[model samples]
Target: MRYALMTLIAVSLAGCTRAPAPVADVVAVVSASLPSDPADAAWNAAPEHVAKLLLQDLVEPRLQAVSTPDVRVRAFTAGQEIALRLEWPDATINDLPAAGRFNDACAVQVPLKPAAAVPDPQMGMAGNGVAISFWRADWQATVKGRGDTIREIYPNALIDHYPFDAPSLEKGSAAQQKMATEYAPAEGAGNRRGGARTTAVEDLIAEGPGTLHPAPAAISRGSGVRTPTGWAVVITRPLPDGLSPTSPSQIAFAVWEGSKQESGARKMRTGWIPISIREDQP
Candidate 1:
C-alpha cells in the first residue's frame, strides 16, 4: 500500500513537471537597417519559418476553401524597426483592381500592447486592439510607377468627354478642379485608396470583427515582387512596444489570393505565433 501511494505521488509529480509544447519562434536577427525590398540579400541571414494557414470561417463572408496553404516568413530588426519577408506559392499575378477583380495581398498583425495573453487573432477583442501592416500587389505596382489613371489601368478602354476636360474651363482653375473632384468623388472625399499612393503599405488598427480603421499615423513600408513560382514580399514597420532582444512577442498573418476571389474577410489566416529577437552574430 505504501509503495502504491509512492507511485501515485510520483506519477502526479511527473504530470506536473511535464515539459510544455515546443514553440516555433520567428526569430529576428539583428541588422543595421531594415530592408524594404523583397529581393534583398540581407534576408538570407534570417531564419525562415513556415506558418500553416487555415481558412477563415468563423464569421460571415468567410473563406469557404483554402487556396494558400502556408507562408514562408523571415524577419530582421534594426533596433527601432523590424522587417518581415513573406513568400508563398502563387501561379498567377493579380495587381490591378477592377469590377469583379481583386488584388493579391498579405498582412501582419501584432498586438498594440504586448502581454502574457494576446488578443484574439481574428483582429482583436473589444478593448484589446491589434496593429496591422497590409501590403497589396496592386499598391506595390502603383509605388513602382504604375499610373493610377483609368487610361493606364485599362489601356483599351474608351472614354467620352470628361466635364473637367472641357475646353471652356481653364486648367487648374477652381471650377475645373471642382468638376474633376465631382467625377472622382472618392478622391475628393480624401480616400487614400482612391488617389495616387507613394507607399505600397497601409497601417491599420482593429478591435473585434468589424472595427477595422486606418491607423492615425502611417509609418509602415513594404515591397512585393513576383517570383518564378510565387510572390515574395517584405514588410517593414516599427517594432512592437515591448519587443526586445531578450523578450518575445506574438504575430499573426493573413493572405488574400485575388485569383481565388479572396478579399476582405474571405482569406486564409494563422493564429498568433511566437517571435523572438536575437543579437547579431559576430
Candidate 2:
C-alpha cells in the first residue's frame, strides 16, 4: 500500500510539471523575387511569427514600460537576397520630424558570425558585430511622395526667404549652390538625415550599445505602409554570410513608438529568435 501511494504521488507531480516555452521560428519562404512593398500579395505565402518584445531596461535611457508588446514577422528569400516584413500595432501615425519628436520605426538585426557562434542580441559584443536594417515611417512618407520641406511639415508657420530659392541666382550656379549649402549645413556635410532619401531603409552596423553607425555601403531597400491599425514594413538586404536553405540562423527586432517618446534605447526589443530558410520551389 505504501509503495502504491508513493508511485501515485510521483505520477501526479510529473503531470503537473510545466512545459518549456516553444521557440518561435521565422521561416523564410522561397520566392522568385523579393517584395519591396509591405502589403504585396506575395507575402501572404510566408508564415507569420509573433516575436514578443521586452523593455530595453538594461542600459541608461531605457524603456521603463512596454509600449509595443510584440511584432509579427515574415521572411522571404530569392537567390542571395532576403527580405523581412514586420507588422505591429500603433494607433497613431507619427511621421513628421521635429524637436522633441521622434518617428515610428523598426529594425532587424542579424549577426555577422556563423550560426554556431551567435552574438549577443543587444546589438552584439565588441568583436561580434551585427548588421541592422532599419525602416522609419517618416522616411517612408518621404519615399511615398510626401514633401520633407519645412513648409510641408508646418504649413501654418511663417518663414522668411530661403537662399536656395532665390530667383536671381542661376539654377545651377556656384553662388546659388554655396548659398543653399550655407542654409542646409547638414545636407552640405553629406549627413544622411538632411539629404533627400531614395529609400525608406538604411543599412547600419553595430558592435554593441552606443556604437551604431551607417554601413560603408547602403545595400538595403524597404518600404512601410500605414495600415488602419498600425504600420507594416518590409526591409530587404543581401543575405548574411552563412545563412542557407539547410543552415538556420537567428534574428532580433526593435520597435520605436514615436507617440510614446520611444527613441534610441527607449524602445521595445526582442532577444534572438530562431530563423530558417526554405528550399526554392517551382
Candidate 3:
C-alpha cells in the first residue's frame, strides 16, 4: 500500500554551492554508496528492461500476513464441527499457534484431533479463503555525531508503505518460497537462498579498527546494539517493494555482515538492501 505524500518540497535552485566534504567524510559516503567494489558505479542502476531502479538499503524483513487460498477462516472457526465430511479446496495456509504472539492475530494452530481418521468426504471441514503473502521490511538508518550516539540511534527514514504484491496464480509465471521446513514445496527450482539479503558487518567492523576511526566491538549504552564500523550505508531513496525474505525480487540484493557489505553472501551490486536476517529478528 503506497502512502500518500505528506508534503512536497519544491526547491528552485537559484544559487547552489558545492563545498568539498572532509576527506574522511567523503570516503565514508563513497564507501557506503558502493556495496560492491569502490570502482563500480553500476550499483543501483536498474536493468535495461527495468525502466527505473528503485534502489533500497534494506534493514530487515518479516512476514506480516499471508493470503490463504480457497478457505474462509472466519466461517470455519465460527461453524460448529458437525462431523460431516466436506471437500477442501486445493490449498490452505493456516495461522499456526505462536507463543508470544497476540491471540487477536490469526496464526497456524494445532489441528483439532478426534479419532484421527483420514479426511473423508463424510466429515465436517472448514478452510480460510484465498491466501495472502504479507511481505514487508523495516528499512532503517542510524544518526551519528554530536551527542547523537551512532550507537544510540539512526537519523534515518523509511519509505511510503504499499499493499502486498499479489502474484497471479495463472501457472508458469513465478514462484516464491520460505526458509522454514514446513513451507518447502514438493518440487521447486534453485537452492534455498533463504529470505532476503541482509547486510553484514562483523568483518567490516574489524576492518574499521585498522582503518580510519575505529569503534568498540560491542557496546550497549541503552536499548540498541551498537557495533562500531562506521555506518552500514544503504541507499534509501527507493526500496524494492512487495518482496520479503520469502518473496524477494530475484534480481539482485546486497548482504551486509556487520558494518559493510562483506563477509557473507555475494557482494552487492551497489546500494544496501534488507535481504538478510539477524538471528535476533532485526
Best by lDDT: 1
Candidate 2 all-Cα RMSD:
10.1
Q: Give residue 52's error in model 3 in angstroms.
A: 15
Candidate 3 lDDT over 151-268, as tens digits, reads 2233453434312222433233334223222343432343222222232111111111112111233111101111242111222211123222233221122222221212212112
Per-residue alpha-carbon lDDT of candidate 1 for residues 1-282, written as tens digits (9 for 90 to 100)? 999999999999987634222226688888888887788876766778889999998789999988999998988899699999999999989989888999999999999897668999998988889999999989888888888678777898898888899999999999998998888877788776745688889999999888999999998888899988889999999999788997889999999999998989999999999898978542
Which residue ranges in model 2 land beyond 4 Å of their true spot? 1-23, 280-282
- After best superposition, candidate 3 residue 281: deviation in angstroms? 38
lDDT of each: 0.87, 0.85, 0.19
With a 3 Å backbone cut-off (N, CA, C), the pairs that clash in candidate 2 are none
Give candidates' CA RMSD values in order.
12.1, 10.1, 27.5
Instruction: Please identify which of the two predictions, 1 or 2, would achieve the higher lDDT against the true structure.
Output: 1
- The candidates, ranked best first by lDDT, are 1, 2, 3
At residue 48, what lDDT does model 1 achieve? Answer: 80
Best candidate, TM-score-wise? 1
Predicted structure 1: clash tally: 0
Compared to the true structure, candidate 1 yields what TM-score? 0.88
The count of backbone overlaps in candidate 3 is: 52
Runs of candidate 3 with Cα error greater than 4 angstroms are: 1-62, 66-282
